[model samples]
Structures are given as structure tokens and as C-alpha cells.
Target: MLTINKDKSRREQIESVSIEQLVPHDHLVRKIESAINFDFIYDLVKDKYCLNNGRPSIDPVVLIKITIIQYMFGIKSMRQTIKEIQTNVAYRWFLGFGFSDTIPHFSTFSKNYERRFKGTDLFEQIFNKILQQAIEHGLVNMDAVFMDSTHIKASANKKKYEKVFVEEQTKTYKQALEEEINKDRQKHGLKPLDFTHEKVKLKEIKISTTDPDSGMINKNEKEHQFGYSAHIACDKNGIILSCITTPANVHDSMVFENLFNKTKKNAGKSKRAALDAGYKTPPICKLLMDEGIVPCMPYTRAQHKEGYFKKRQFVYDEYYDCYICPQGQILEYSTTNRKGYKEYKSDPKVCEKCEDLGRCTSSKNHTKIITRHVWEEYMEEVEYLRHTKECKELYKERSKTIERVFADLKEKHGMRVTMLRGIEKVHMQVLLTCTCFNMKKLANWIWKKGKGGPGKGKNLEVLLEFFSKVVLAIIKPHLSFIEKWGFVNNLKRAFARFSIFGVLLTFH
Candidate 1:
């Protein structure tokens, strides 16, 4: 009963085994293979390929697929991904490679990316293609978007920084910001302040020599570290619309314009945007309002120090253009400084005998002053929106969308630390990570929801019929009408046609 069967290895003849049979039908690789269209990579990389010169290149599609697999499975390095792909049956199946097909060397990916795809928009195009598919499937809600940024540790040590004096860069929105400030003041019956003479000041900084593009930043009470910040904007459904990377020393407010513009381009007619207090600046609120997006910003933390009366206690009187203090004293407008702050000062003579002088001010003049930005009203408008029911609900989704995205990027997708130096390379990593995320979500959505229940497949039939009609309608239009229309008119017609297509497709 305890005897073991020992037999010499015999070569079996004509076995019925197949690579496809070795892979489970329900495997994730199979799902990805069916859900994603890899053909687009051919077009995306076409220009990089030689038309009639040199040896035939390895398929760029396979190379991209390998990278996607690496990120999807959280493989830490290209070498590991290559080894896994060579041994794994499902991976080989997904990649359209035979078991005996030679996997490319690990250096192949890095070399190809540097020589062919670096500094190109191929990654962005792929990302947008996947996101567009999600949009068609009704997985994204662009009505409201959430924006936030997170820091990723760079490939440099903190101690490897050099101190140097750096000139402050001019603000890109300086002219627009000043114009908005003047308009806001004019609305409140105040004269426009002079901004033609504003001067910028330079400051000293610590630059990292190892990763020169990375910036030295300090968060909370922690020691300074070299890192980069990734600002991301996502739809209410948690689909990332855009991602922008900057040095960690870059403030959220400084990068708002570029990030907002990119998100707007991809988000498709968003009605509102949710942002953290770091984005609660006056210019940001005005920008959102100007773009017809209601700003949902939380209450900014009070700036008053302890033992000082809060500025709210001193209410502004529109009739007198002054602040009414708690002790019933007029704090008249003193001056509009070059920095665009309207400073109000109280009467020291009246305050020297006040009963609550200790709580009011400890200045030798025994008076208090308050400064307000010219665009404070816009900020107040955003603050008011924060307390509304709609805004409160939208703000609650921030954690569910942008925050969770960052958590997944850092904790699961190997984005917590930089694998490559330089901003360009880091950006490439971010794009690839986001593309993989969108791919995973797309696969899950399609597999779980792409097929309707029971007779609902008939709905797909009707949908196909509707698109056929749309094409017919567009073609049936007169050639004379097309010739008579300009580019804008053609764009409008295209949009109208797509709207009709969407209605019919969603007619379940």
C-alpha cells in the first residue's frame, strides 16, 4: 500500500495538448485580450518605424502590451516582467506569442522607449483611446470633477542638494489675474489699483544635483526630500481625465491653470469642479466662475494667531467703506498697498482706553488692522457654495475619486518611488500607470456589464441599426451644404450627429 510508482520518463506520442487549452477561459489575461484593441499601437508608432530601411523591428504593439502587463500585475522591473512573460502561459497567450518564442531582452523596452517613444504623444494617445472607450460605455460622469496632487519620492537623496540663489519665475497668469482683480474692485465701487509697476523678488533655493529636475520639498514636520508632484483630475466616476507632473516645490496654486485647461479639454463640458483648500485662492475661484463651473471649495483655515480677535468679528460696512469693530469703532481703509491688499486700521486714540485692549491689539498704537485681497469677494462666493447641499455632496466624492486614485497609484501601481530620473521619464511612468489603470477598469466594466441580460442583446441590434442610420444621415446631406459651411459649422454638425448617436445607444 505504501509502494510508490517509479517509472522512467517516456516520450508520449501525439498528445492532444494546446497552449490555448492550458489557459483558463476566465483568466484576466483572456478578458484583457478580448476587451482591449491593440491595433491602435501600430498607427501610433508607425512614424517611428522605418519604411524600407534596416531590419524588421519587433512589434511595438507587443512591446506596449508587455509594459501594460508589467503595470497590471504590479511587476517591479522590466527584467522580472520579461522573465514572467516567458514562463507564464496566459501571458504568452495574451501577447500572441508561442511558448518557444524568444522574449525580447529587458534592455529592449528602455532602448525603444528612449529612441522611438520618448517626448512623443503616443502614450497620451493610447490613454485617451482607452478613456474614450469608457466614455462610450457610459462609465464616466463629467458633470463634476475632483482635483488633487500627491508627492512621489524622486530617485535622489535629500543630502545631495546644493544651495543656490534662484530668480523667481514670473507668474503666467499675472496679466489675467490683475485684470480680474481690477474688475472685482470696480464691481465693489473701488478704484483700480496700479499693477504696471509690480516687481518680482528672487529667493534662494536648494537644488538636487542627482535628479536636477526633482525639487526639494518638505511636508508636515518631516525632513526635506527630493520629489515630484502629480496633479490629477478625475470625473465623478473616478475616471482620470488628465495628469500633470511638476517639481514637488511647485505649489498647487501655481500649476492650476495648466492642469485645469488639460482637464477641461478631456472632461467634456463639466459643470462644476471640486478642489481642496490649497486651491481656494481668489484667482482659482474666478477662473472656475469664468469657465461656468461652480467652485466647490471648503472653508479656508483662519489665519489669525492665538489671543487675537478673529477678523470676522470686525464686520465691513459697505455704506462707510470701513470695518465695524466689536467695540463699535470704525476701522477705516488706510491704504491699498502694492501687493493688492486693502489694509484697514483702527483709531489708536480710541483704542488706548478700550476695556478689551488686551484681546484687541498689543501694538504700541493700541489698534488692529485687517487686510483683504482685492478678489476676496470671489473667494467668499466659493466659500458660500461650499455650504450648499449640492456642493457638500460633491465634496464627499473627492475621497472616493481622486484620493483613491492616488492611493492605488502609490500603494498598488509602484508609483510611490520613481524608477527613472528626470521629469520626462517620470511623466512617461505616470502615463503608463494611468493607461494600465484605465485598461483594468475597462476590462472589468466590459466583462461585467458589456453583455446585457436575457433578450437585451436585441438592444445591441437596435443600437447598431441606429449608428447605420446616423452614417446615412451624414452622407445624405448635400455636397453643396458641406461646401457652403465653414470649419465651425462642420464641427457643430459632427457634434449634433454624435449626440443623436448617443441618444439611440443609451435608449435601453
Candidate 2:
């Protein structure tokens, strides 16, 4: 039975509606607004605005919120985000716009960024603020951290690159390496290698003309392209503590110190760091152990030719300072190179008479050489730690922590490929994307705890209690002086004010 009725009620419907009412109660935007405060943006950008300006400008918070929407929802472009906002009830409510209020033009954010936000650390401040909020909420666990880098394809053609010659940049650990090398040479009764008049070497690299700041990435059997690498450090809870951006050609080990130091400053010292094979170098292992942090890394396969004996087969005799080959031949140590490797050469005459000469040496002289870094002891420690129970368990969390974070950023935050050109712009993009990612996590955590709405005092009591305990623990030994100075009452008042107004209040 089909009854066709011509009803145009949709075209004639006119009932008063509230934008807030149109949005659902459990929407993500509502949770985000409830879990975090956006008022801090006013103080951060106040200097950028003119008080006695010609006209009232759009709220800087609104501009930032607009970009947040673009990344939070994985919208492809700002124009598309604007269109979505204009039609989305939840977005309109989040931005505090009325049903009929005009959504800002898509170009408004770009114009504002170029004029007010360019060359500023505004995005980084926002990211740090959000991360601090997470820390305060007890959402970050810095006991163990995971570090890695993911490549973002640059908006450039692969074939439009120009090969250019440039001076190779010196490594950050060059001075330290030279000192260690000289010390090793001194121990062996040899002269230190002179580096005073060493010339810088020139290297050829491909640069994209369209996006000169991006470097050509040609690894992992992927198509060659210009791209940028985003190095991120995350806690066990998958909360990003710090991020640094560099050209894609930069190795993970090169920027590891900067990234780790930044994370340490923000999140305090971590007990351990889990990394991949790319960060299994001597310098990295030494850096972590020197800072009293255990480094957990996977087993990196030794680089050897096919059908050749592995390096491990040669037993290193530390007492004699030599290596014993599989055929029981002693390879005596010669000299340590500037690259920090101690060379060991076998006797050509003895090797020529060996039955395994073909399998061992391909050189015309029939001599086999093996090299070991002076700092190999630190690498040995790391390899030993890799087998320990604690490190093994910590290393297993890498897939759940940093890998999951990279997947989320790419699939949910539009970080797979960046449309920006320069390193600075791409850095800002990464920061904002990570900020939004943290916000979502914070919001969901709060929501799951049954504190989802605005002004609900989300974990305020818990924070206040924790703060009181920490304060007492720090000043317990000085209680006599506090009592003598009549500060006990003042301390009580301070606690009360903290419980009321949070950390914004200070005792003067």
C-alpha cells in the first residue's frame, strides 16, 4: 500500500532554535571545551593586537579554534573547514557563534597568520600549555618514553629537484668525539690526529626547487620525494611531550639530543627511552647512559656482505686488545681512525695459507680487517639492557605508544603530507596538530571519568590533595622554622585559595 502525499513542511518550517540545543550532549567539542580552558590564548596574543585599532578584529581565540577544527576533524583544507563550520551545529556551538552569525572567511586565518602569527612562537606556547594541562591532570606517565620520527611528504614534484654541492655540516658531537679519539690514541702511545687545518668536505644532495626547505627522502624503497621529518617524544600514555621538525634527509640520531632534552625539560627526567634500530648508534647510547637514562633498543643487524661470516663470530679479547678470528688467527690492533673506530688487520701471509681465505678475504693482499668503535662498551651495555626483563617490557610498549601516536596523527590529524613549504611553517603545523591530538585525549579521559561538562571541577580536588601532599613533603623538615615565623596560618590560607582558584593564586 503506497499513499503519496505532497507535504512541503521542510520548506515552511519556522521554529525558534538554539545553536547549543542543536548540538548533542556528548559531542567531542563540548568535552574539549569542558576539559580545557581556552582563555589563556588572550594573554598569549594580547601583544599582537592593537587596543586602539581602527576596527574591532576577530577574536584570536576564534582564529585558533578555526584551525583546531581543521586538524581535529581531519578536514582537508581551510576552505572546506569553513564550509563545514558554517553548516555544522556542533562546530558553531563550539566557536560560540549564533545560528545566523557569519562564519569567518576561509582566507581570514591565513591572512591573520601571515600578519600576526608569523615568526612567533604562539603555536608552541599553545602546544606546551595543552601538554601542561595533561600533566596536571595526571594523564602523562613519564616513567618510560618512546622516541621516533615520521616523514611527511612535501608538496613538491619528485623529478623537479636540482643537485647542488654544499659543505657537510659538522655533527653536534664532533668535539666530544675528537676528545675521545685523542684519549684513545694517547692510551695506545700514538700521536693525536691533527684536525686544526682539516678542510670541510663538500657533498652533493638533491633539493626541490618548489619547496627548497624540504629534503629529498630516498630510503626504505619508497619513491623519492621531497619531505620533512617530524621527531616526536611521547610518554607511556602516548602523550606527546616534545616535537622537533627537520628536513627529511636528517637522520633520527642527529636530532635526538635536542628532542630528548626538550622532552626532559618539559616532562622532567624519564627513567628509560625506547628507540628503534636507527638510534642504536654509539653516541646515542652514550648520551642516554650519561644522563642516567636506560636506553632500550632492538637488535640491529650487523652490516656484512651476503655469504660472509658475521662480525660476532670473531671473539674480541679485551685482555690482549685484539680479535681472535674463527680460524684462531690473532688480528692485532693497528690505529684508531678519526671516525672513532679501532682498526685490526690480520697477517696477509698467514691468511693466504688459510683454507677459508676465499670465504674471509676478497682483497688482493688476502688480509681481513675488522673495526670497532672506541665507545663500543656503551653499545654493549645497551645490547645487554635489551635482554633485561624491564627493558624488554619497556621496548614492547613502543608499538602501543609512539607508533600509535604516528598513526593517529596521520589518519586523524591530516599530518600524512603537509602543504606548507618552509621548515618553520611545517613545524607550526605539527605543533598545532599535536596540540589538538592532546586536547582530544584529555577530553576523552575526563569524559570517561564522569566529569564531562563545563565548570564541573574536573579532578580539582584530586589535584589539590596531591599538591598539599607534595608541599608537606618538601617542607616537613622546616616545620619548626615555619611555626616560629607564624606561617602555619598563612600556609592554610594559601591552600584554601589554591583549592578555590587553582594555581593562579600566589602567596605573597
TM-score top scorer: 2
Against the true structure, what is each candidate's TM-score? 0.83, 0.87
Off by over 4 Å in 2: 1-6, 451-508
lDDT of 1: 0.82
lDDT of each: 0.82, 0.90
Each candidate's root-mean-square deviation in Å? Answer: 11.4, 9.9
Clashing pairs in 1: none
Candidate 2, residue 177: CA error in Å? 0.4
Candidate 2 global lDDT: 0.90
Candidate 2: tens digits of C-alpha lDDT, residues 49-141: 999957899999899999999999988788999999999989999999988899999999989989999999999999999999999999999
**How good is model 2 by TM-score?**
0.87
